[model samples]
Target: MRKLVIAISMLAFAGSAAFADPILDRQALMKERGKIVGGLAKVAKGEDPFDAAAVLTQLQALQANAEKLDVDALFPAGSDAGDTTAGPKIWEDMAGFKATEDKYLADVKAATAAAPGDVDALKGQINTLGGDCGTCHQTYRVKKG
Candidate 1:
């Protein structure tokens, strides 16, 4: 099931890449990331049944997602004009933005390596990952109602 999910995700990403609309592509990627995080959060908060394998699967998915991110291509020079929540800061400080993205990828990699076997451990991993997400969102994302 994990393999199937990964395969399907890969296919979807590949299919999406052909279109090459950075704004929409980036939005889709972030949405998938959010969904993955939300699933993990449900388990961490005891809202969903904790399955060690499922947790690992989600972590692996996050790792795969992070591994495939091409931030430069995703947020090109002219993409800021469209329907996006990406802040101007992303373009102004591209290096800083990439650094933050790198930190997020690192955090996700570490959590996946830790492979939290239970809910308590999963909560810690989720907290760390969530902090990384919040850090990027707070700095790089424009909040819109």
Candidate 2:
């Protein structure tokens, strides 16, 4: 009886650990993206001086992350239950979710290629890039308080 209980406890712990790893990874990825956006926001708002080289580097990093982010793998089944801000609609309408992801990736790629030469050029691209971010968050993510 004691052995049975121990085994069950171990199995439950293992299951939860497996579930948690992906959630943690996804959270870290989101935070990294958020930091990149925050930097760009500072430049956009004139809180920070616009350095074209720095902005281009950040945009490249953003593009790299976007390219490597596999939405389906990051968001496995049952991931929406825990510490996640993802909405149920992501699993329900996976096609739409993927479409949104793809659009964001495309936008990032375009922005990276454009590589805005100055603050004004960067500002011009901000609307499109920010819109992509906002659209996905609005449609797919749950608001956290």
Best by lDDT: 1
Q: lDDT by residue for model 2 over 31-129, one digit each (tens)?
A: 889899889878988999988899999999999777756777788888889888989998999889899889989988998999988888888777887
lDDT of 1 by residue, 8-107 (tens): 9999888676438888888888898999999999999999999999999999999888776788888889899979999999999999999988988998
Candidates' RMSD to native? 3.3, 10.5
In model 2, which residue pairs have backbone atoms overlapping below 3 Å?
none
Model 1, TM vs. native: 0.89
Give the lowest summed-lDDT range of ten residues in model 1.
13-22
| TM-scores for all predictions | 0.89, 0.83
Model 2 poorest 10 in a row by lDDT: 14-23
For model 2, the local distance difference test gives 0.84
Model 1, residue 29: C-alpha shift (Å): 0.2
What lDDT does each candidate get? 0.90, 0.84
